[model samples]
Target: MPTPGVDRWTFGVAPLAQTVELAARLRRVTGLALSLEHAAPELDALLDALAEAERRLAPLASADPAPRVGAAVDGDGRVYLDHSRHIGAFNPGFPEYEIVVDGDQATGTVNFPVAYEGPPGLVHGGFLALFFDAAIQHHNCDAGVAGKTAGLELRYRRPTPVLTDLRFVLTRSLDGGRIRSTGELLAGDVRLCEARMDAVQGDRARLPPVSPRREQPGPV
Candidate 1:
């Protein structure tokens, strides 16, 4: 059986798999755009080609299909942002972090490329917060405290460097159905950031019934 929040569609959804691959390629392209030097005068041609490609692809927007599942919260058992297309996804368009769960604890690892840089060689602070948020959510779900984030607090201890692997761990507790979680980001033995988060228990009752079907109209 797959983990509760992990998407089984990862193996079966053709369009999603293709989209994930395309996003991975774009991430590499973004890193190259950020770190490439001007020794070669190819930027102009590259920009022109990108612009033409954008124009050619713009028409596909109108043809985009609606999502197959429309559950509002993760606990509804629908594939969503955390496992699908959001920045926190295991998919390639985002951090592409690897996570493991052990009881009430969750551990994750990620690497930031030049495209995620902010100050010189360091990772952006906002991205660090995003990482913590995702980690907390994963920990909460794995601990069986499914909910939506109500508040998040973060502290930056040092500059997180880019193009290097980083580690994060989260521990969670529950009180009155609210989840309280803490997470930390580290580089080897060095701590970089810390986070505390609170989430309210979601109402699973709002989710649609299993095997729901549209009512057919009778002949007039």
Candidate 2:
């Protein structure tokens, strides 16, 4: 079952999976572009090729991203694109991570690519916060419940390195009708960051249902 207020698809969605993979490759190219150096000497040809690709694609797609937001398509229970998901199964700019859930507990791994660097080879604190929020919500959804983020708090212990596999674990519990979750990022035995989040379990029944037939939304 898809988590309330968070998940829209549960993988295996036709074309959805394929598009996500393409987005990932796009991310990889962007990361490489950011880390390119003069020593590589291949940047000119790369940039030219990329520009040509963009020009070819420019007419096929819109520059505005709002269409994807709240857009609906039939898939695993009618996929609705929620660009805010930090896991970036769809969005290319968000932090990328893989998570696994077992009941209320979940564990995941993330490697902050070069494009996410902040203070000298370290992952940005802002991005780490985003990762935790997404991971926590992901756990909630997988646990058969979910909601909007009411509050999130993160503590940075040691600098989180970019391009290194970091482990994160989160546990969720119910506090009255609200959901509470806590998680940590670890570098081997060393703790890198910790997070505590609170979310209001919104009534999924009250949430708007997907409208798959609507065309792309335009400005009013």
Write down the TM-score for model 1: 0.73
Tens digit of per-residue lDDT, candidate 2, span 71-118: 222322333454334457666777888887777788889898887889
Q: TM-score per candidate, in order?
A: 0.73, 0.76
Worst 10 residues of 1 by lDDT: 7-16
- Report the C-alpha lDDT of model 1 over 44-138, residue by residue, as the tens digit: 77788889988997764424233334442223232323332234332443465777877668788888877678899998888777777766666
Write out the backbone clash pairs for model 2: none
The 0-to-1 C-alpha lDDT of every candidate, in the order given, reads 0.67, 0.74
Give candidate 1 misplaced runs (Cα > 4 Å). Answer: 1-15, 39-42, 63-93, 208-220
Against the true structure, what is every candidate's RMSD?
A: 6.9, 6.1
Best TM-score among the predictions, by candidate number: 2
